[model samples]
Target: MAFTESSLLLPSVSGTNKNKNKVPEDKWYLAYIVYFTLGLGYLLPWNAFITAVDYFSFLYPDASVDRIFAVVYMIVGLVGISLIILYSHKSDAYVRINVGLALFVVSLLVVPLLDAFYIKGRVGFYSGFYVTAGAVGLSGVADALVQGSIVGSAGELPDRYMQAVIAGTAASGVLVSALRIFTKAVYPQDASGLQKSANLYFSVSIVIVFLCMVFYNMVHKLPVMKYYKELKVEAVTANEDNGPLTGPVWRSTVWNIVRRIRWYGFGIVLIYVVTLAIFPGYITEDVHSQILKDWYPILLIAGYNVFDLVGKCLTAVYLLQNAKVAIGGCIARLLFFPLFLGCLHGPKFFRTEIPVTILTCLLGLTNGYLTSALMILIPKIVMLQHAETAGIVSVLFLVFGLAAGSVIAWFWVI
Candidate 1:
């Protein structure tokens, strides 16, 4: 799996021996960019929706629609990925990713279109609700396809590529956070301005996802990428000892993978559970300020995203060097729950924006570092043949954590 030596690298299926010598050692950076961009596209829609809580609250008027949307998105992502795993056992990662991204482009467009109509008094709340729910749910399906495929695909490559995809995910959060902050500040503080800005935000997301499809399709053409895919296929197929395990979509195959990597899976779950339980929703629904009441949630979401990106990227420099240390950091994020509560009900100073912002930043930082370390380390811990399955399973754990955390987010209101 450690593809460091020159002798180990080979020409692609159609490539020649001379082409192998021609490939610049650094060309793999292009592949990394492709993986990162896909990762960014996979999560940008969710970030856009989450960061725009004020618009949803204004539209629905009293219903906790944002929380409901977040929970529904997570649940649907889990179900969608499960179906992909159990049913659609296609080896063509490109087709799966493209179809999902195309769906993302179309679904994101539907939101602003419907919002425009609703603003003109031609549509009702239920119309907007159904549209938003359907759009968010559609994005969740795209997330499963893109995320699971990219991670699982990258998992089979060198670990650094997998880290690249995770880095792209963190970058998406940061991108959307910056976009939201700028848009909110520039747009007028009215319903019309909100609608205009929201449409612009989603429009930009559609463009990025579209470019993601274009770039990913191009990435497959790279000789280095083709070599990795072939290498993975040979690894799984060439092993004569793996008789029944050769069946990719079998229940037993999935079970065996889970059984072998239970600790890594559980660590991934705890990482997301602690982070999501209080993010977006807690920062959206709870906490307050007189001066920044309207802008507070948006800015806090930005803070979390910025720190999360910083944390995830930090792994490239100084990973904790131990799996347990990484898991410990994730569990430590649970401390955020009580700390956030203190912000809500403990000391008056704790409830202020400054202290809450500091805690939120720390939460994001720990979450980013621990989750990245565990994901980067997990596949390497398992047999190389099961690396792809391990990546998909890691995604399953992430959705489980998101589902659980979104459910917990509601308890603050209940």
Candidate 2:
């Protein structure tokens, strides 16, 4: 049987190949924008929960809010990714992504709804805290679903789309930081202000997530998207002739993909481990400025976000084609530990605000560039048919690094 049941469902490879020379236009870069928006959308939930840390911390005074949130979010995300990878052969990326978007909407609504009716700007409501934590976990699962699927999907496309996704994630950070700064500037620094700011975060995130859904649905209709998707189908038909993938065969295929991308995965892991250990936590809690007061951390975060966005965008101009050199760059990020340390316990000049701010921006710059480089490089390393699986495997490693780095943040901070 040349054409199995699965093959029958897919568009005819010969038919698709006919128009291979006539590449469909993206038309105003709509598909690119949609992918970038989806990348931004998936991370907004996590950013919303974390960015509103001030409000959550104010509400739950006894609990260590940031650390707890990190643990809950990362663990749930790790487990969710594991399950997705295990069953990826059975699932469709399109369906998984749509479901994940819906889940994001639900999770974003939880905190604001709880605040409006139950919490009501009150402090010491541990019940609400727990519910909020559950919402964070829900967002984690959503992240695993949407991020893995979309990134995997993008992996099958040209490098620019992946760059858009990476840049969009950085844009999510910048968006949240900008909102945080705006809210802080507008509202008074009090309970009412915290409540308003936090609500604004969730509300804006919700709106963007909706926009993401609309764009995501519309993207498939674009001629360019259809072209690439058909190409993927053609590639799969050519390479995977063994009919429906049985459990053993799928597992072996996954292992093969993993083996090929192990170094890339390790580089991604190391990148995040170093980054998560020092960022936001160190900037927010450890260091203080006599002049800027509470504003110091906020500004530092903004600077980091801005520089990160800059770094991610740089790849659009010039992507380092060498994977080994990029992995080496990831390893080089380890030097950031001591450099950041100098801002704390070293010489007087190093301990000043100027040095600390420079280091933070540098951290973001390196993090953004290296991460974008690695993600764009991963799919190119594997066969087109297995590119999606390879992308998902890379995400698993990224999440593991995130979880480890978050844990390390607890002890690494001075």
Candidate 3:
């Protein structure tokens, strides 16, 4: 069914004028802020687990804590997202997001509860490591349920909401980095200090996840949200009347949507492949500085996170709006490979803290802007009825990138 601009502008209802129910206002931008908060909240659990890597490493001395976390989380998330894409038509976004939010609370609670009651600042507890990894996997599953739904839901709305969601993801990183820095400054560097910092991360994440649950439920009650959702329902109903969306028909429709957005998907995959190959793994494990000592990685991570937030927010002011240029920019990000490699094997100056830090910030900046561009562009390319599926499909491609990038991180970094 061809969904034209006029159809979306004036969806058929029982008895309403074409221009009677114009799109409702967001009213102080509450819906945008809620979406922003939802985006931030979903990633916070993953960040909490990753940001407390030092403590986890200290506890599980035998394991490659960072690499293992990345692999397990990304793989699990990839699988979960694939399943979400397959069964999206059978379910709904509202239920999926609520369930995912609850799961986030459960997964986040695991670490601190275990530490407080059982682990108790002890060492040589491989079992604890395994349990923690399981928690990470749970968070990954939660992320799949929540991230795709949030992005897909936003896809059905105006472009600004999508920008808010993408920017919120970057903000999550900045928030975690700030928490890491605060904990480092306040707590002593001993075991007690590490445990305290780790606990703080989980506690803060739990609070935010709960807030997201509240705000998310509150948002649907808003008039602006009702307006968009009503239009979506009308569009879907119109499409269904043409014929029942049988399995094969739906699959073919999904494939068509994929074909249209394949270039965007490729760019997203390449972006993460280059980024994950060099980041956190390289910054945290490979590099070292005599002056900054333990603080070097933290500073580098903070710089990257701050710049990422800047890049994501920039789209709000001036979106590129051109897919060709955005994809080319993603291709250009590959240069980071050589630049970062130089930090390891190039001249003395390239190996210094300054060059490495700048490259890392650039990596984040590019990652943020390019990802937001592709995501915002995907839904616009598809019909209204398929926009949600398109959003989920895009996220599935993104998870593939994350999974591949995580695996490569182990081998790509020196």
Candidate 4:
């Protein structure tokens, strides 16, 4: 079925002569920037919100309230994300991507408004979790749809786009650190004031998301060639081949890809999940503890983002030069060891900040490379004929990993 789809999508075979020129280099760069900025808007301020929420908890002590909020947020996010995947699979790629970006912008705007106008003083520990999950889920769905559309039109997807997205996430982390510093400087004496300042950052993030959305739409419109049209036609036909869409059409397609891909990548994802789960509190708690006084976590996050961006950008070059999937997989797997060890033993074995910092940097660098490799590997393994199916499969894998990690963290605490 995928073969049939790929044949239809490919210009050589599909015989559809729409736009033959290559995607302009400038447009490609702009697309990356838009993607990166969008990512930053979604993730950066959210990280700050997470930190602020933790700080609020200390200001207004209530364990039961916090737990209740957390559970509810997680449940809603899980359901929302599942729906998003289903929607993306069923809807046109263009609509899904555009709507997803709009949703993200809306969430960014709403959260800040809620913080500034209504919610005050640690409304719940899980408030950030709930809000962020919704924002990110919307963002993810949009991303899947947009990428699928690009693949459908172009017969190929840019491997670097994924890295750009992560890079934006890393950049946002750094920005959060800067904001934390400003918050500390301005509101040294009052925790409530600092929380209000955090709200300001969220508001600013909304503007960023809106701008990126506009930029992406504008760029998408200017006379660009068709690269993925054959891919799209192939996907439509493949769905037809599989029989009428019924219950869990997206899930069925995704699972089939997972079964086809080499188990090694799945293993790597599992290891990453386990490592992240074991150290669930580190990101929000340890980073907060270690850096809050000086806004150190923001610095570490920034460094992580810079390296992550570099790693992602370079992935295409690496694959082109090396062209070895297993080697890339192995490299990504090896990087996890230090992360796992750092989480497990960083506190006990390395009391000082230096060792922990080194460990953290290594984790970011390796993971950046690994993530890039993983993104590239997916299209190759799944076959271009089933690009849409592959995209759905890739996102589902990420969603499951995220969901599992969140659940495991909760379970461990319980």
Candidate 5:
């Protein structure tokens, strides 16, 4: 089939191809923006929650709630994705995304409400934490639904759209990082101040989510986008001999995808393992600087977020064509373990801010670039009928890596 079922369903991207199938030149940018917006909406929730590590720790001081929250969020997302795979084929992509995003914004709004209603001190800290964790899980469900559907939807679209989605995910990191920097700088450095700051951050997220939902629904209505949807449906249905799979065929189709992209899956797992094992939680808790003091963790995280954006964006300029090279680079990320360890308990200079900052940037850059590359490659290599499954597989690997890395992160302080 000329258009994979995967791409056919995603918010259509603007293609420069002059072919009859491509959207016209004027509509191209609008379509691309819509697709990019979908990517932004899918990931911003996780970024907003995770980036607030310092605030979470401040609120739930006694328990290791941050680590627990991090791992649980990923695990819940893993579970959500599993559920999505079972019934996702039965649903429409447009409906799935709007509903998911609506739920996502609601989850973020709940954060401030927890702070408003609950006692701020130790008396009700655990209660507050529980509410917050529940909210995080809600966000996870939203993430899984929106992310899997959009990527799966993009299956029939151009590779650039996938790249745009990945890049948008990285952009979320950047957005959260900036929000953290702003709120922290503005708010007073006291308990009440931190609470207010965190609330303000979530408020911004609510606005973004609303805009995203509006834009997403609007994009699908565009003449060009609607035309492609009808075109793909006609094309794929005309070849019903190998049409959408049923229960027996569905199971076999997913299994075949696993076999085909097992290596890509491994690389995805390792990349997140290396990343999740040490990111905002460890970075917020473990690293310190006598010089930067409180500013140390904040700046380091921001640096990582910015560079991660840079890495994801770099692929648009030049993606390494070889999967081996990309996979090999991911394996090498294991080195960050020892390198970080050395910073914790090595030569005095290693413990300093300069070395740690440099390493953090490298970590973000490599992680961003390699992850985007793998996501882009896996779908193209798989069969058209299973492209969405392949996208889901990639997400499955991501959450597994996140869960594994979160486990490893716990051991750091133990």
Candidate 6:
């Protein structure tokens, strides 16, 4: 059997091979604008968490603020997945995309407000959890919307949109990390004080996103709604071919795909969870201890972001274009088993902080390539059928990854 299920399902092999080249050159610019604007909104509050904790710890000395934030993030992710399934099934592409963008911008704006007012002066671990979780939970609404738009437009747009997303994430991570470093250097006291200054910074980010939303609405001349209409048509066509099935039958089919794909997605997710688990310990114990207090997190984050950016960019431009599903699957499987062993043995050999940090960075760099590869493979695995099911599978894999990391952390500590 051929590696790909069918050539007809493979999105255009080359940019020039697209069916309807209706995407205007101007639309490409709009896409970049969307990328940069939303990128800033997503990252600013995220990076701000580091600074916020510095301030919040002053009031609540015993709380593990980062852990609190992480737990809340997990919950928000679950809710977000639910929203994606519901909205993607019912809503048109344009409404879903626009509403998603709006919600995301609103979430960014709400973060500062929550911290500055409601959680201000509170002195407990859960305070950070509540504020961060509430902000991220709201943001999940936006994420679902964006993903719905992506699935709806999958075959319609160039691969550049996916590229832009990865690039934007990398850029945001780097830029926000740099900004935290700069703010610490110049306004050292303010960075650690009431967080009023950081609140101001996030407020500026919200404004930029709002402006971008307005611009996107104005310049989006293509019939974005029509994309979802077409998706519905495709679904109907598939149903007709397969013959009408009961709800239970459809459920069974989706579950079968989920089970088959779990190992593939889980492999990638495990790598990430291990990296995330190792990172905080290494940064706090090794990196911060060795380096200047202010420079440690910034440098590590900057390096991680740079490597991730390079990996994703290279994959998008080269690997994904020539991707064969079998090759992609083999690489994922090969890398995953070693990576898992590395995570298991790493703490034993690289017992020191510095060595562990290096290991973490390598893990990050390798995982970046794997992540980009996985995203590309996802569409091919499911083809156009049951895309929403595929998306749900991806999210569940990530959640499991987090859980696995958390469990490993407990064992390592013991």
TM-score of each: 0.88, 0.95, 0.94, 0.72, 0.88, 0.73
Name the lDDT value of residue 76 in candidate 1.
85
Per-residue lDDT of 347 in model 1: 89
TM-score of 5: 0.88
The weakest ten consecutive residues by lDDT in model 4 span 1-10
Please report how far candidate 5 places residue 243 from its true position, in Å: 6.3
Instruction: Write the residue-wise lDDT of candidate 2 on 189-284 in tens digits.
Output: 789999999999999999999999888988898888887787787777786777776698888989888899899999999999999899878998
- Find the number of clashing residue pairs for candidate 2: 0
Q: Per-residue lDDT of 1-414 in model 6, one digit per residue for the tens? A: 222323424332343335533423534466555644544444454555544566655555676666666556556655665555443444565677678777767777765666667766565646555656577666655665554354334423334444555566566666666666666666646434447556655766576557756755763454543443354355556566676544666667656767766756765576556556555554444333334465665566666667766766666656543334533543454443344345445565444446544655665566566666655455455545555456455655655576567556546541
- lDDT (Cα) of model 1: 0.75
Top-down TM-score ranking: 2, 3, 5, 1, 6, 4
Query: What lDDT does each candidate get?
Result: 0.75, 0.88, 0.88, 0.53, 0.77, 0.55
lDDT of 3 by residue, 90-158 (tens): 998999999999999999999998888888888988898899999999999999999999999998888
Residue pairs with backbone overlap in model 3? none
* Model 6 RMSD in angstroms: 5.5
lDDT of 4 by residue, 319-369 (tens): 432325534554455554455455545666454556656666665666566
Number of backbone collisions per candidate = 0, 0, 0, 15, 7, 0
Q: Of the candidates numbered 1 and 6, which has the greater TM-score value?
A: 1
Model 4, CA-based lDDT: 0.53
Off by over 4 Å in 5: 1-23, 26-28, 53-60, 117-125, 227-231, 412-414
- Native-structure RMSD, model 5: 4.2
- Candidate 3 regions with alpha-carbon error over 4 angstroms: 1-17
